[model samples]
Target: MRVTILGSGTNLHPRRAAAGYLVKTDNLFLMDFGPRTLSNLLKTSADRHQIQYLLFTHYHADHFSDFITFFFDAVCHSKFVSPRADLRIIGPKGTKALFGTILRTFPSFNDSEFRVTLKEVSTRSFSIGSTRVTPVPVTHTDRQTCLGYRITFQGRTLAYSGDATYAPNLIRLCRDVDLAILDCSFPKNRPGEAHMHAGECGRVAQEAGVKRLVLSHFYPIADRFDVKKHAAQVFRGKIIRARDCMTLSV
Candidate 1:
């Protein structure tokens, strides 16, 4: 399977776009549609209609703000429409309500030209095609109940920590996975309230025995530090500092 980091920046960072990822097998699957998601996807050669699944980790603006533009484009453009498309959107408990609010807030998206099935995901395992997905709750903020996902496909596993502080569940969820895409939002020395720093990410990867560690959701200030030096301290495997449009195969 191939995984692409579509957008790898946090909400507050303008140099890098918000979070988004594209996982491809026989079909394409999108995870987190942030502010620049549509534009980032357009930059790629991949067809938009190929996306069969959309998974939202949380409702934070950086994680989900681009859904409006994506819906608009998909509804208005024929080329982007999937002929046999069954777009399955999975997220936390309030997913349906959040999507309903989006449609209500934007009348253009309310038109029923396309088919979208919204599903709620908690700390449980579920199936999407041949892939098995497990959601693990993470500590974000009191306002939101965030989740990190571990996706197992074709005997390969990839874990994604969706914008959260260092938590034990994250380590457990990522254990033995081929790749762990972590939220290394801050630099090693710097501190943050709801995001992981480079040092913390390294320790987690070490404990989890993750084969590869990809650091993302980078803040602009994080660029000032030596990420590799910090992450290498604990993680003994491949440590990738993700850039927009970077792809990884596992």
Candidate 2:
């Protein structure tokens, strides 16, 4: 299994990062479609049409804003085509509603000939193609129902902590996974409502016994947070501070 960090910035863009990831096993799958997702994937020579599944972690604009572009390209652009025979989108309870909103929001792109399937997932394990996906609710903003996911394929597991603080369920969901892609949104000293700090991630990583810990979702202020120095104090595993387009083989 290969995992690529399409975008690792926080809510802010250009200066900070937006959330996006690409997981592929011959068949491409995308995790969060934040701003500039398609553009970033293009930078890696990945075709948008090759994406067989779109798994959303939450409904936050920073996490799902670029979905509009994907929908538009799927409908209007004939150059891109899905190799997996179908495009399956899996998200939280409001996934169907959100998918409809995106299509309705763009009238010009509504005249598509392709069919897009939207599946609303809950805190349960399900399958998308050959991949086994498990969604675990996380504590993010109160306005939306947020979730993180543990995906398993061919005996390898990848746990992604979408956007959450230190939640016990997240720890359990990620336990013993091959790779843990966690949300290190802020630094140690800087606290936020719905994001995790590097220190917090370290503690979770140690408890979960994750084989590798990849910290992402960096903010502009992250440079001043000394995440590497602080996170090292807690986690004794392989730690990587993710950058845009960083790829990992698991």
Candidate 3:
């Protein structure tokens, strides 16, 4: 599978966009849809209608605001945009309610024209076609279950830590995965409480024994320092600094 980094930075970063990723298997899977990511998503190699699943980590505005536009274009405006398939919105426990609320707020969206299914996942393994998905709980907030997803397809495993602190669960989620897309919101010295710093990303990758590590969700301050170098201090594996529109075959 090929995974595209639609948006690699945090919300409101001057040069980078918030969280958004596209994993293309037999079908398309969107990891997160943050502000300014819709345009990037449209620029991908695949068309919009091919997207069959939307996997979200949490409901942070930076991570979810673009869904409104995505829904409108997919369901209402582009109703005749080729032969569209049913879209599944997957997230934490409150996934269904969030979409229901959006439907309520925007009565104009043609919900009947297209079938949008909401599936709320927990810290358990589930399946979509032949793909295996595991939503692992991470430390981020108390209001909800902050998830980092581990998706296995055709024997290849990829994990994404939406927005999380350095914790044991995160290590488990990324353990032995081919790639670990983690939150490196801040540089090592400049740590973030709610997110992992670049050093922590390396430490986690090293402990988890991941083959490769992608330090993403960067803040502007992180750009001032060498993030890759910082992460390399602990992790000896292949470390990639995520950039917009960068695609990797995993």
Candidate 4:
């Protein structure tokens, strides 16, 4: 499996774009279509028209605004150029209703040349082609439900934490995975809410036995400090500081 960090920073960042990660194996899977992420994805060799699944973690604007442009391209451009297979949008509960609202809000997105399916999942395992996906609830915001995905394709497994805090479920979800793409929204001891810091990320990586720890979703303040150094204090494994368009083979 190959994982691409399309956008590693948050909305507050200047140099880095918001959350977006693409995982490609037998199929193409995307998580978090934040602002400017599509522009970064276009830099890669992968074809956007061939993306099979659109997996979301939550509905925060920083993590979802680009979906409008992505869907628009699929509807208008890719339809006649390089028509692909059905687009499967998988998210937590309320996904169907939320997307229905989007479709209704935009008349241009009304009729798609191809089929678009919305599937909601929480604490449940589902399959997309040969890939087995497990969606687990993670602590992000109290008012809205958030999800983290654990996907297994072929013999490799990886987990992605969308935006989360330190929680036991998050650790359990990442246990023994080959790669753990965690939310390192801040540096060590940085005052923040609803996201994990670098030190906490290290502890999670060590405890979960994650072979590779990918610290992403950075806010601008994190750039002032060594995030990998902080995470390495607890985790002895490979720690990667994510950069836009950085692709890693898992």
- RMSD per prediction, one decimal? 1.8, 2.0, 1.3, 1.1
Flag the better candidate by lDDT, 3 or 4. Answer: 4
Output the worst ten-in-a-row residue range by lDDT, candidate 2.
77-86
Residue 157, candidate 3: C-alpha displacement in angstroms: 0.7
Q: Clashing pairs in model 1? A: none
lDDT (tens digit, per residue) of candidate 2 on 1-250? 8999988896665654489999987468999989876677888877777777999988888888887877766766653553223578889999988777776677765556666788988787987668888999887778878789998999999999899889788898789999999988888998676888899999899998998999888877776777876777999998999988889998
Model 1: per-residue lDDT, tens digit, 45-135? Answer: 8888767789999988999988887777777764344344656788999999988788777867766466778899888898877888899
Clashing pairs in 3: none
Query: Which candidate wins on TM-score?
Result: 4
- Compute the lDDT of residue 161 as modeled in candidate 2: 89
TM-score: the better of candidates 1 and 2: 1
Candidate 3: list runs displaced more than 4 Å.
77-83, 110-112
lDDT of 1 at 158: 93
TM-score for all models, in order of appearance: 0.95, 0.93, 0.96, 0.97
The lDDT leader among the candidates is 4
Clashing pairs in 2: 9-17, 10-17
TM-score of 2: 0.93
lDDT, candidates in the order shown: 0.85, 0.83, 0.88, 0.91
**Candidate 3, residues 1-250: lDDT per residue as tens digits?**
7899989887899888799999976668899999888888878777877788999999998898998888877765445645467888999988878888887778666454667788888787988778888999899977867789998989999999999998899999999999999999999999867888899999999999999999999999999999999999999999999999999988
lDDT of 2: 0.83
Regions more than 4 Å wrong, model 1: 78-84
Q: Write the per-residue lDDT of candidate 4 for residues 1-250, one digit (tens) a residue.
A: 8999989998758999899999997789898899999999999999898898999999998888899999988898756777667788989888999998897788678788788888888887988778888988999989879899998999899999999999998998899999999999989968499999999999999999999999999999999999999999999999999999999988
Q: Provide the lDDT at 226 for model 2.
A: 77
